[model samples]
Target: MMSDRLFVYGTLMRGYDHPMARLLSSNAEFLGTASIPGRLYLMRHYPALVPSEDPDEHVHGEVFRLHRVDEVLAQLDDYEGCGPSDQRSEYRREISQVTLDGGTELDAFVYYFNWDVARLPRIVSGRFQPEAFSG
Candidate 1:
């Protein structure tokens, strides 16, 4: 997979009322909405994506064709609490296949949560909208 693409959910998704969303939108090409097989959890104020073994479950998000992978990833790593060599990083970047609205699939970089999910609430809808959960 090329380093120029990313699959972002939660705060990074467009219209999510977050700084990271605005930052990414201004610098990356918004490919469109997409989904991958995963489970979304309400991790406090943000969200976490964990790969799901169930084929029917999906995590709704957006896909972007990034122009500056290094720069963008650097900022994202900080926001995600991830480090280049730290095993304690909250998230780990990995490549996964995401299916677009019209069923086109593409490999993109996804930040998978690295912590335990014993208590996180599962988003049954497989989608996370800021307005829906924000107080």
Candidate 2:
């Protein structure tokens, strides 16, 4: 069985408040923190990741080696509102190069935002820190 890998940067990252975090942790090997070149955004409730060409911008996240990719992704696809037939979904799954904390790089699946972020606020820290909504 081939093990698939995924990199989650937002709610899916361990220690977040999202319930999906537990599901992912139980089904995959927690490979520790990793980062990739991108810009993070606050898109209402959750954060969105947009590709960045800037070398200085590295989006922080976690890496997981999945033993049951097909099953895991199917569940994640629903949570992320992504699928093979959903072109209108807010996020789209794509393969990206992620660098581990120690500098090891690996190709992993990532969910990229599909909508326009022109007016969205950029998360300057590159880390998605979840907080309670003041509203």
Candidate 3:
């Protein structure tokens, strides 16, 4: 099976310094750290991505190759309250180009949250860090 690759910049990183680390396995490949040319900020237990008005702002995270994507995607859907069917859920899974720390960009599927439905303040301005996101 082709491995399901994803980009995880916050808690899902290897050292898993984030509490939600429990939500995933440590064996997942920590391909490398990367930054999207956008502004990122702390939210409860996760980071929030918003369109960067500034051309130079960045969002830091790592790329991961998931073993069984269907299962993981289902779990992620539950976690994000996507209902395994809701297209309007905050976190939407999509494929996009992600760049590594050294500037090498790769294609991967990432679960991104729609800030509007998140019902939380823009992280860059709020600076709220939580171990879990329940909303």
Indicate the residue-level lDDT of 85 in model 3. 64
Candidate 1's C-alpha runs over 4 A off are none
Off by over 4 Å in 3: 1-3, 17-23, 51-54, 83-87, 117-135
Between prediction 2 and prediction 3, which has the larger lDDT? 2
lDDT of 1 by residue, 36-98 (tens): 999999888778889998999999999999888889889988989987688888999988899
lDDT of 3 by residue, 16-133 (tens): 5544455555435567767665555555656766545575666667777766677776776666555436766766766777788787888876666665634654545322235444
Kindly report which residue pairs in candidate 1 clash with one another.
Answer: none
TM-score, candidate number 3: 0.69
Backbone clashes, each candidate: 0, 0, 3
Worst 10 residues of 1 by lDDT: 9-18
Better of 1 and 3 by TM-score: 1
**Against the hidden true structure, what lDDT does model 3 obtain?**
0.62
Please write out the lDDT profile of model 2 over residues 1-135, one tens digit for every residue: 233899998888888656789899889999989999999999987899999999999899999998789998999999999967778898999888899999998889999999999999888888887774336
Give candidate 2 misplaced runs (Cα > 4 Å): 1-3, 132-135
